[model samples]
Target: MRFRFVERNRGFFGRVAVAVAGAVKASVAAIGVLALSASPAAAGPTPDYGIDFAIIGDPGNRHVNFDEGRRFYPPYAHEGFTVGTVNYKYRMSRTEITVGQWLEFVNAYRPYYDGPTNAGQFTSDWIVYDNSLGRYRAISGSENFAANMGWRFAARFCNWLHNGKVMEQWAFENGAYDTSTFGRDDNGNYTDQPVRHADAKFWIPNLDEWIKAMHWDPNKNDGEGGYWRYPTSSDEAPISGPPGTGETNAGTWNFYDVGSYPHTTSPWGLLDGSGGRSEHLETLASSSGVRLTNGSDWGGLVSFDEIDRTASELPISSRSGLRLGSIVPSPPAFVALLVVGAVVAQARRR
Candidate 1:
């Protein structure tokens, strides 16, 4: 993937201004513009699955397992306390998987449907099985809504994408995760694979990956490293309301359209990390029988969506949403992009 460097102002006001009214459209356009430039692109081209991803490039950054010494009412979980600290680079979807994206996967996989990972269950009632047509369709006006699916189904979606999105049964079984590992052992404990294969190109984000994307800022502390209190890139609590009325369309009674709050974004330019829907992580919760989920749904309270709050649910539960994680493109493309980025930084200083 060839790319040209698009120098962006990393200042606080600069980020806010870029994320105004037409944010989603502008972000997509910016991705395209990066690809058209002569140097290596910072992010890869939008994949065939149509999920645009943001590049998380800070490697070997230290982790912040605690609450930065803030002794809030509820203490931090020091047991699984690690946050950020990824030694390698990766990319995460800018927003949760939408109903339309799920529908396309369902149609392709239906050519050879398996008993499990039902497409109908992937997005609540927004995606329904059309008996007459022998396929699934997205509800009117729900094509862009974030999808909530079972963790297993989300894993299979990653498998399908990793295998080039083929329509065969094998394509959905094993690529990033092994479907055969989706059973419990004789001890009655869940026996799913603990992590994605080393060669995995796409898979569910683990705790580290998800937290880093939502919180880590490479430019913090004179480029040493830092994290935000919330995914909206602000330490302040977001006001609850409809799009264009608040920093985030979260902490409300209903779900807002995905990416509706164009003004909210993480340091890496990811959207809806706090509101929208709580997303599943491959990391297991501290509690047994549930997997960890980061962020909170639209209906959650202000404290529920804070960076310190981590939610979890049963793996079979379809309550959590999906965010696809992927490795950065080939080394040559990434290296070229970085070189160009450095040159641009130097030019800006002059």
Candidate 2:
């Protein structure tokens, strides 16, 4: 099954933009400074059942490294559970992660940038929070809460949870700075532990996968006129009246938190997969040589449909976080023996 994302351009949403040229190119000098700490322990398996997703079915690239630079189409596009060079299986969970859970990772796995209150989150300087509004607004210089977090923090968290050790070591040596005296090392480095990259233990969900999970209109071909007003279930513009309400006439209206619908679920029961944050993805080329990154962040605004973009799309800010699903291996059952006449005699001897 697949999904289609729609957008209401009447709003003045200005997403973060990246220079396509700079984004596709590899910059080693900036990577070290750009890097941040990450650590994610195994949360265990998500118990996979052989249930096929039933929703819209339709169409939809990858590259890595800097030899010729990474590139991708429909950024953040990827294949899930490949079947002989094709992604035929669904690859995602249906949920928009909570701030509390992310806080745990920030506290235990990567706590270097934990700002003022020892919350162990990003620097508050990056964004602002309105308790009354219960939402995050862009700012800078480290702050706690989901809104202040940038694409960097989200990406770091994904790496840690997936391949804890490799991603963690890279960050500690690169982005992290010593903070606590009680947790110092011989070289003054905090003894931050590392996690591994064993499959997608916990990685960001792609935009398309997210769309499939959130409000996948089964009628894309069935000929229903719903969700045509906004992206998926998002009806109202922003700041005020929720998704099902009337549009606020774009610019005159203000932007609200991602997936404010509160009930935005795709055909597979996923939440805010497309709206909340810009989801990052790793793509590969048919040549088996390069990998590229496509993202949902787009400086904050993005849509599942190519025709939904409000402004020019960029590659930067594509970094986002992810949730996980599980599949467990079942044990075989043994058959019982009918009758054993000799068993009784052996018991009497004991």
Candidate 3:
């Protein structure tokens, strides 16, 4: 696969690319980081799935699992969380939540939580859900969880809700659904608002939803199928020498930028899921012993080939950061146009 980054940002992207290669050389893999869960969610739990519907083959194969010695995995980790009101059936919006998407959340609650993860889940003091203020604010969170990393926050919200917990923390704090609404006896005075799903974008992924957004399909069938890390998965740290190394299939590849290999992208054209960070769907494990605390971040997404084989055996925050997971109805037209322009511009220069 080939990717042509814009010229103006080529230098910057180059630095990022180099750093990614360096990190992969050191053998750090961006698995998945999600907040920990403590209970077994309902038997048939469904998370708040949000994203452009991609026709996934088997998304759960790469999802988290538990080792009670019974080997249990959710239908799809995305299926663990849920959104929309009880009466509303949600249809995921295509595309990931972009940087702009989370900013809305950050800005909306500025008066409440003013912390500085950049996504606005905290208050100015950088604390999370500070209770003393009797309002929404950030408390001093050191561990990575929902909110800051973007997509992981989306996944975390779903994980929390799938556990049948207080999924309405944000809305309740903002007074969107107050006591009057809960105890409403006057049907005539109900506000002209439609019942929103919890956090509006949280839900589980059906097989189709997962595959399309991530754009992954593995030929290896390692467990369910080979765990393709992300788009730049194959382009990561170039294999320095002979075979038997984990970075390359033949172990003779070389360093390349994330998503630089566009050919590896899914047929639907999603990039970097195999060689980059593993986007969070939900929890990796409900066991306190094995929980992921952060979402897949940019650093994680660039070097898919560098990961070790124990992928099925590690904890999450032990993973990486998050992305702007979206629920957009379709891949944005602009993305394709942008890629075409990048490719053309690079070729012309040559």
Candidate 4:
């Protein structure tokens, strides 16, 4: 079920006379960024299941803290690691996967659920199975709350979306990712794949995608660009409070509904990137079991607003939510790039 990502090059540049191949590569890379920035991809229409996304552009952009000097509270060694460089364009969910959206997935996938028990499938506190209804439902007012179903279930959710929300066993197992690799090896090391297949339609955002969504601002540094210290496009930490009262929900005791702070957004327009629920990223913290998570939860400290901070969690840990990433629309990578060029031209003319 593994697929290779096909790299496509447009011959629009005709020919290059560079002596070094590396120079040609650099030149093409520059063109890609210029093309994408001049005409950034538009966020696709919301899907039938209702997950809206923010288009992240500016391919081949530089990473944050490239020299690795950035540090924050506690200053874990890995905290200094550089991130945010991504070479392709994709869309990231505007908010963490919400309870209502997960409910739709739960009802669609429940009839085919063959797991030993559904106990670990969701955060019992927010979503629950009703014996009378024979389907899962989000608790009373938690419909818009961020769902905390851990990493593996989140992967399954991606698989479901990749399969177009089909109500079949295979749809919940394979597509964007392979569930067969979900098991551990003889030496007790987890065998789950570290990333999604290249041809996937939708999957969990990797650490780079997550960081770029939360911090990278293309218009920064007088349009030359740079990353922000926080997801709110600001260097200062956000103020915490309930909906409409603060810039973020983190460092506060209560979990407000997703999008409670519509004005508080990442440079790319993603909401709740700093608080609400820590996001489950596909980047692995360790091969044994730990996976990487980004941002702070509703009860996180003020320092969690720092973009460099991250936490490690087991794949089965249900303490975090997730965000999905998808190629512009369908496959054939160059088509998406072409769309970017078309949009860019329109914007420039205006």
How high a TM-score does candidate 2 get?
0.39
Candidate 1: tens digits of C-alpha lDDT, residues 12-127: 43443333323434444655544433112233443646778887876777786455424222354444445667777778899999888888877776666555534445545477
TM-score of each: 0.76, 0.39, 0.33, 0.78
- lDDT (0 to 1) per candidate: 0.72, 0.32, 0.32, 0.75
Q: Which stretches of candidate 4 lie over 4 Å from their true place?
A: 1-48, 66-81, 114-120, 330-350
- Write the number of the candidate with greater TM-score, choosing between 2 and 3: 2
Residue-level lDDT tens digits of model 4 in 158-203: 8888777778889989987898989888998788878887667788
**Which parts of model 1 are misplaced by more than 4 Å?**
1-48, 65-80, 111-120, 286-289, 331-350
In model 1, what is the error at residue 347, expressed in angstroms? Answer: 25
**lDDT for residue 149 in candidate 1, whole number 0-100:** 82
Q: What is the lDDT of candidate 2?
A: 0.32
Q: Model 4's lDDT to the true fold?
A: 0.75
Residue 269, candidate 4: C-alpha displacement in angstroms:
0.7
**Which has the greatest TM-score?**
4
What lDDT does candidate 1 reach at residue 241? 82
lDDT winner between 2 and 4, please give it. 4
